[model samples]
Target: MLVRMGKNWEISEEISKLQGKIRNLLKETGWSVKDFADKYFWEELDSDGAYGDEDDKSRHAEKVKKHLSSSSSTAKRLELLKKYVEFIETSRLYRKDVMPLRRETASGMQDAGFKAAMRKLSSELNELLLKKS
Candidate 1:
């Protein structure tokens, strides 16, 4: 069974709750912070957004690794988690799609595409916010 984190009520609260759940998950699963970041962060993050260059992204990932490795307080970890959630969400929301502007395009294709993308992102977010029990 998986231990789910969010109440699906409010984004802020849900994210906060998720961070704590993630901390426990890390402890229980014997996964390093780097493992978690590699599994959940790099793939979804937009390098063209807040993380402009590959180097910048690498540095940020290192920062997360160090932060988690330290004896940081629980409050600090939760705060960092909220920021990470925000970074991914903001990048995805503002990312410029490469869709070609064609006058002959189908009427609802763009909308359908957007819906599909959102569904995929939501599913990924669920994996991050859930812990295997």
Candidate 2:
């Protein structure tokens, strides 16, 4: 029924809304994080001693990636998160008692640019489907 279809669309819309927030958060904070990493890496290298060309953003970005990546293992972070979640879920009715908080899935949140592409594709497909019918 049309009502069920609308209800189903609600989840996708929620996903889209959450995806938009994630994309914005990543866009804003990724730069801030990288900037912090870039400074830290630069300082570490400079203290240990050397100067790369001042104009090269690529060089700085690379150093940030290298150092930021080496700073923590994803496996360890995930392991900690798993234990934390288990503790929260089992030891207390944490999420059940809390007010609803919107969040994206850890692995599946997509950037809005991709969502725009998907919308474009969906529009084209809808047009084609209508013609075929």
Candidate 3:
């Protein structure tokens, strides 16, 4: 499980909790941090024009934060979170492929704090999926 930095929840604890759970699931299933970010996240992220050829294939932690910090439609955010859970579910059956890979754009990404947040979001989405199951 990803260790969240704060005790008190911020921006809806329920969402954070669920996000964390799904994030942990991704890790347990061998998905990297990049897997959480969507293409929109890439457009907002400034990677110093690095890996122009790779594009969405990679991203840094700072870029991830920049993507998360900005205002965006909830639908987009929910879509990414939903993908995370679905990817894990499918991977268990040997379908490890995810369209538009979210691998690390660079080596040595910093700070696990945002990852914790993404995880929380992912978990929250997974919870929603479960409710319907």
For TM-score, the strongest prediction is 3
Residue 34's C-alpha lDDT in candidate 1? 69
- Report the poorest 10 consecutive residues by lDDT, candidate 3: 92-101
Question: Deviation in angstroms for 36 in model 1?
Answer: 3.0
Write the number of the candidate with greater TM-score, choosing between 2 and 3.
Answer: 3
Query: Which TM-score value belongs to model 3?
Result: 0.34
Which ranges in model 2 have alpha carbons more than 4 Å from their true place?
A: 1-31, 55-57, 66-133
Candidate 1 lDDT score at position 39: 38
CA lDDT, candidate 1, residue 103 = 24
What does candidate 3's lDDT look like per residue over 64-97, in tens digits?
4443344443555545555545545554222333
Model 1: pairs clashing at backbone N, Cα or C within 3 Å: none
Please provide TM-scores, in order, for all candidate models, with all chains considered together: 0.32, 0.22, 0.34
RMSD of each: 14.1, 23.1, 19.7
Q: What digit string (tens of lDDT, one per residue) describes model 1 on residues 6-87?
A: 5332444544466665566555445556655653455556533655576866676687766544544355565677665454
RMSD in Å for model 2: 23.1
Which scores higher on TM-score, 1 or 2? 1
Give the C-alpha lDDT of model 1. Answer: 0.52
CA shift at 97, candidate 1, in angstroms? Answer: 29
